[model samples]
Target: MGGFEDREKAFEAKYARDEEVAFRVTARRNRLLGQWAAAQMKLTPEETEAYAKSVVQADFEEAGDEDVVRKLVGDLTAAGIAIDESTVRVAIEEMAAEARRQFMEAK
Candidate 1:
């Protein structure tokens, strides 16, 4: 009985760790996506960093990535970047994958 209880506790701990990692990865991915957009928009280095932080903050506007996507699409369009929502969505996916890979490697 003790062994079973220990296993359950271990599983719960692992789940919590995974959730934290996932949140960190999503933030990193958003930052990277923002940097990419900033580059495309010809933002200066200082502006790029600030823009990335704004992108990270945009995630808080909702429960999921839709808010981030919407923010990116609107900002990019306003900056004359000529990007569509689908392209931003694809970039978000790609950045997420890259973020996960980088996080795993760091672990």
Candidate 2:
């Protein structure tokens, strides 16, 4: 019983840590994507930082990545940048992969 309880506790702890890492990676990816978009829009440094934070917050608007994609596409279009949803989605996937790699390397 003691061994089983210890194993259960370890699994719970591992699950929590994995969740935290996933959250951090997603946030980092959003920031990277925002900065990429901001650069394309030629935003100033202050504006870029704010934009990045906005991208991170955009994730909370829904359960999936659509919210972030919509925000990026709309903002980029409004800024006169030629962009499509498919392109933005591809960028998101690439950025997410990069973000995961970076987090893994840092660990």
Candidate 3:
């Protein structure tokens, strides 16, 4: 019983850590995606930083990535940048990879 309890606690701890890492990676990806979009829209440096933060916040609007995608697509279109959902999706994938790489390098 003690061995089983210890194993369960260890698993729980690993799960918590993994969840934290995933959240951080997603936030980093969102920030990178925002920077990319800001560059596409030719935003100023200050504006770009703010936009990246906003993008990170956008993730909290829902459980999945749709909220972020919708925001980016709508904002980019409103800014007169020709972009589509698929393009943004690709950017998200690329940013996710970059974010993961960054975390790995930091490790």
Candidate 4:
């Protein structure tokens, strides 16, 4: 019983840590994606930073990546950039990998 409880506790801790890491990775990916979009739109340096932060905040609007995708697609199109959902999806994957790599490097 004691060992069982210990295992359960450890599992919970690991779950929490994993969730935190995933959230961080997602946020980082969003920031990178935002910067990429901003670059495509030829935004100023300060505008790029603000846009990146806005993208990160956009993620909190809903679960999954739809919110971010919608925001990016809408904003990019509005800026006269030719982008589509598929391209944004690919960027998300790329940014996610980069984000994970950054985290791993940090550790």
**Cα lDDT of model 3 by residue, 34-99, tens digit:** 999999999999999999999999999999999999999999999998899999999999999999
2-99 per-residue lDDT for model 2 (tens digits): 99999999999999999999999999999999999999999999999999999999999999999999999999999999899999999999999999
Off by over 4 Å in 1: none
* Clash pairs detected, candidate 2: none
RMSD of each: 1.0, 0.9, 0.5, 0.6
What digit string (tens of lDDT, one per residue) describes model 4 on residues 1-107?
Answer: 99999999999999999999999999999999999999999999999999999999999999999999999999999999889999999999999999999989998
lDDT of 3: 0.98
lDDT of each: 0.94, 0.96, 0.98, 0.96
* Residue 21 of model 4, lDDT score: 98
Worst 10 residues of 3 by lDDT: 98-107
lDDT of 1 by residue, 2-86 (tens): 9999999999999999899989999999999989999999999999999999999999989988999899999989987888999
**Which ten residues in a row are the worst by lDDT in model 4?**
22-31
Give each model's clash number.
Answer: 0, 0, 0, 0
Better of 3 and 4 by TM-score: 3
Instruction: Give stretches of model 3 more than 4 Å off.
Output: none
- State how far residue 56 of model 1 sits from its true place (Å): 0.7
